[model samples]
Target: MTLLKLTGIVKTFPGVRALDGVDLEVEPGEVHCLLGQNGAGKSTLIKVLSGAHQPDEGTIEWAGSTVQFSKPTSALRAGLATIYQELDLVDDLTVAENVFLGHEPRQFGFSSRGITRRRTRELLARLGHAEIPAGREVGRLPAAGKQIVSMARALSHDARLIIMDEPSAVLAHDEVENLFRVIRDLTAAGVAVIYISHRLAEIREIGDRVTILKDGRTVAVNLPARTTPTDEVVRLMTGRSVEYVFPPRSAAAPEGTPLLRVSGLARAHEFSDVSFDVRAGEIVGLAGLVGAGRSEILETVYGARKAAAGTIEVDGKPLRRGSVKAAVAAGMGLAPEERKSQALLLGEPVYRNVSLASLHRFARLGFVQRGRERDAVGAVTRSLDLRPADPRRTMRTLSGGNQQKAVVARWLVGGSSEGGSLRLLLLDEPTRGVDIGARAELYALIRSLADQGVGVLLVSSEVPEVLGLADRVLVVREGRIVREAPASDLTEAQVLDLVMAGERAATAR
Candidate 1:
């Protein structure tokens, strides 16, 4: 039986018609993967279905009955729950507390500790997680650990349909495999799943059927995963031929001087004795699992995070750690992994966030000259193709893809070639959560930056992304650089092997 049916769904946000007469359906005991590009109304559809926002026009028939979900609790009461990309589990709470948070199993009109623990443990076991103690604080648990707890919480709600958005984005390769196993178990128990993710590989792995969304409408639905070509899904979501999106690799000068070099880089309990060099006009990628020190290594070089022992050399000049000002003085720009937290100022205006990193360049003596700043930000915004080119618009209002472009814009502005202002760019998970077309744009932007002789060290968890975009890829695990290979010939299996080989205790992928 069809677990959920959505018809003629429509939602509008200010100037954006987020969803325009959308349609979707999910069957019981099936994984229905939703595919779409950024700003294509995917989130809006999910929000409407989950009752975060009411649809302007639509109808939802859930479990054979038409119902209106005015709030999330109402949806949950109707046996539907959603897990967002940013898991809603409270970090300060215990696993059991989070699992049965709102409606804890109660006896005598009070909390039943024994029953909650037993129930939490049972849910964890059913989800293939027996290692996590129910009483342990969720703040202390790993990301994957917290995810399992979140899943258990959904089950605790007695939800018949579970919607997971980008469930595998933060999970390591092995953890992803674990998640797939759990998803199988859920479907086996007749739970209908709505899976939304950008990782096409994971969709192919576990999705039984797919629904493709383009712009604000469902373009196709109920396509069997095996029979449908992956490229067809790509085309449907992007509206760009796969050839145009990926394109041919751009040529770069491969024989330039080493722009940035590291020797014996060490960050206590994070990364140890890591070393690599990125040549001028080159894109060097760091590929590893989420906790394998990829971001730490980049942070160490950027002076955002402290390093116990290491040496960084830019343009062949040895440098010491500490002080982000010093790192910037030495010609380094770091775009951190958590773009929202570290880079973009959501509350501030677009021009402000774009010019934030190099505000001094637009300063005159003791005051900021807004004209000079506006000019700089404007140029970068136009060059990067940031929508509207409105310097006065708030960063928070822009879509995810445009927000990322603004972050990249920060690094592009200010810094003469002769000065030590913009020589090296360190981008951590540059394309994380961004769509395929945006990713292609970012890759092209990096290639353009490299062509301008800026060395780039891109840190990403998706090994395939590294292989597709980088000139050289470095694999790190357990704070150590285990292998370095050309991205062209490096395979995902080889990268996983290096990550697992370096981590003896890690589970197999």
Candidate 2:
């Protein structure tokens, strides 16, 4: 029997037709992948199916009956569950509480703790993940562990259809394999899985069929995963020709004084015995899965994280250890992963965010001179081409891409004043949340920074981004720096392999 079917589904967003007459069909015990770029209608289609939105016009037939869901609760009642990229679990609640949030197991006509714990354990065990203590707070758990809890919660609804958006995005490679196992288990029991991801390799590995959405419409349907190449999928999603394979790159790094070097760096539970250097005009990528200690290693270098053992030197001069001030003084700047959370103060004005790092120079006696700050902010705003040209708008009010530009403007402007050239720019997912056009500009900026003798360390989970942007790639796994391969010599499979084989192989040479 057909599990679900949608025909002529349409949805429109502001100034964008997010979905236009899309079609999809799924069968019982089949894993279907919804493939597209960030702005593509994949998100819209999933939202419609999961009852987050009402399609303007469509016929949804499920379980041999035509139906319409008014809201997510109705969809859940109809046995459809959605696991979003940002999961909707309450951090303050317990794992069991989050799992059975809406409907709790009550005893004697009242909620009972003992029954909830038992039910939570049973569901988690079925999912092959029972390590999540029912009593422990959800916030205390790591990201990976929390995802398992989310999955458990989804299963608690007894969903006949499960939609996972970017399931393995933040997971280690081995963890991805484990997820595949769980998926296989679910499908074996005659349940359907709707998967969405940017990682094409995983789509090929686990998906039985694929649906391609582009420009708010379904371009192709029921494409066999085995016969269809990733390049074809990429072409469909991007609507442009892209070389799936990389060209041979042969370019020597800049031969100059070491811009930034760390010796014997160690952070507890993060990284150990880590050391490397970025030369002038060099773009080095730190590649690893989440929690492989890649971000912590960079944070330690930037003095954001305390190091147990390490020595940082800038241009042959020793830096003061364990101090962000000292690292910035030594001309090191970092754009962290959580741009909105870690990098930008959302409530502040755009100008304030731009001048945050170097306010002292624009101020006299610790009093910020508004005129000087405005002029400095204006110069960067025009250079970066930020829209609205509003100096007074709050950072939170700006769109994602523009806010990202503002954050970069902060360091780019201040870094220039600290030194004529940008000394070191450590960017974690710099092009993240930006549009394709903005991404190209960010890449150009990185290249320009490198040309200006700024040593750049680009950390990203998106393999193709690192492959495209970095001159050299250092694959890290299990808190140690693994193989160091030039961009020309490196391949996505090779980097993923290193991440999969963690700790035991722990590539040291």
Candidate 3:
């Protein structure tokens, strides 16, 4: 019997029909993989199943009985749980308290901390993470540990079906492998898992059956996960037979004095003696595993972090260390890795967000000019092919790909406006959380900026992205630059070998 099923699910929000006549089924002991591009109704369907939203039309069947989940608590009581990409755990709460937050084990109508901690310990052990102390605060744990705690909370509710959305987006390679192992064990115990992810290789590895969603409908259901060709899956999800292809490299090498130069840059334990030069019209990439201090280096160079040693110069002029204002004034811009938390104002409109750095250009007589602001922002957004093309749209309503475009567009506006020309652009995981179709656009956009004589400094965890898009690559390991080579001189395997060499050396010692 199917553990859970949804038939003809229809959901609509203001001006958008997020899901239309979608169907899905999950069987006990199976990992049901859900694949789709951004804005393709995957999130809406998950919300409907988890009782975050009531479907406008459709029937939900759980355990062979038709049911309606009016709220989140109702779905949890019925053995369904959702783990969002941004986990909802309170950072200040202890692991035990988080696991049994609303439905704590009680003795005589009073909460029992002892029983809660013991039960939480058992769940962590079952997930193969017995080392996580129940008394420890959730914020103190690492990314993988926090994820395990999320699963433990679901287990505390006796959840028979758990929906995980982009669980590995923040995890490193080893941590991702561990997560898969836990998923396998959960499936072995007959718990159903609805796994949603953008990585096709991961779906092939961990999923038993694949369901493809496109434009709010399930186009293919129950395809064998391992046997299906990636091209076929891409076709179904994007309505195209190809994934985002990287743009061709520039034929001419960049010339002239460096647009941005860093010498002997050091930021305490994060990174040391990092030196690089980005010439006008050059794209240079930093290639490393996550937590290799790539982001920290970018932040330091951009003056977000004070350098313990060394100097940063833009256009041959030194910048004030640890001052973001100075970096902006010096024609430096950064699209950080975490756009939502570090860069964007989700509550504002797209135009306002795009014009954030160039606000002075739109100001006159101690008042801001809204029309001028929107026009300038609109031009940049159009050039970037921002969808819906409506600057008035709330920033939060757009897809991940469009949001990233806006972040890049902000700098484009500031670069050309009377503020200052953008000489050096720092992109941290520019395509993170973006779909394949959107990635191609961003790749082309980055190259286009380079062709316009803007020096680009890129940091990406994906080795191939660095190799394909960068004119030169810097391989970082253990808080230092271990190797530097032309993009043509390095292959993915060679890069990985260099990256892992640090780990091997440490282990040997």
TM-scores for every predicted model:
0.92, 0.84, 0.96
Clashing pairs in 1: none
Q: Pick the candidate with the highest lDDT.
A: 3
Per-residue lDDT for 384-443 in model 3, tens only? 999979999999988899999999999988673447788788999998888888888899
CA deviation > 4 Å runs, candidate 2: 243-252, 344-410, 413-421, 429-445, 461-468, 482-508
Q: Each model's C-alpha lDDT?
A: 0.84, 0.81, 0.90
- Candidate 2, residues 1-509, lDDT tens digits: the string is 89999999988866557788999999988999987755567777888888889988979998989998889998998888998877788999999999999989988899998999999999889888877799889999877788889888888888899999878856766678888999999999888999987667788899999998877788889998767976688778775555233323326677877788889999888789888888878889998888888889888888887889989888888877678877887778888877776888889888998888887768798688999888889888888788658877788756555777787787777674454445888888776555344465567766766776778998988788888888888888878888888876888877777777555446435
Better of 1 and 2 by lDDT: 1
In candidate 2, how many clashes are counted? 1
Candidate 1 per-residue lDDT over residues 1-509, each given as its tens digit: 78899999999888888899889999999999998888888888888988999989889999999988999999999989999888888888899999999898989999999999999999999998888999999999988998899899999988899999989878888888999899999999999999988888788889989998888988998888767877888888886766234334546446756888898898777889888999877889998788889888898888787778878888788766766777787778888887887787799999998877777787788999999889889988999989767888998777677888888788778753224457888998888788887888887888888778788899988777787778888878788777777777778788877777745524432
Q: All predictions: root-mean-square deviation over Cα?
A: 3.1, 4.0, 2.0
* CA lDDT, candidate 3, residue 201: 84
Candidate 2 vs candidate 3: the lDDT winner is: 3
Identify the runs in model 3 with alpha carbons over 4 angstroms from their true place.
Answer: 416-418, 503-509
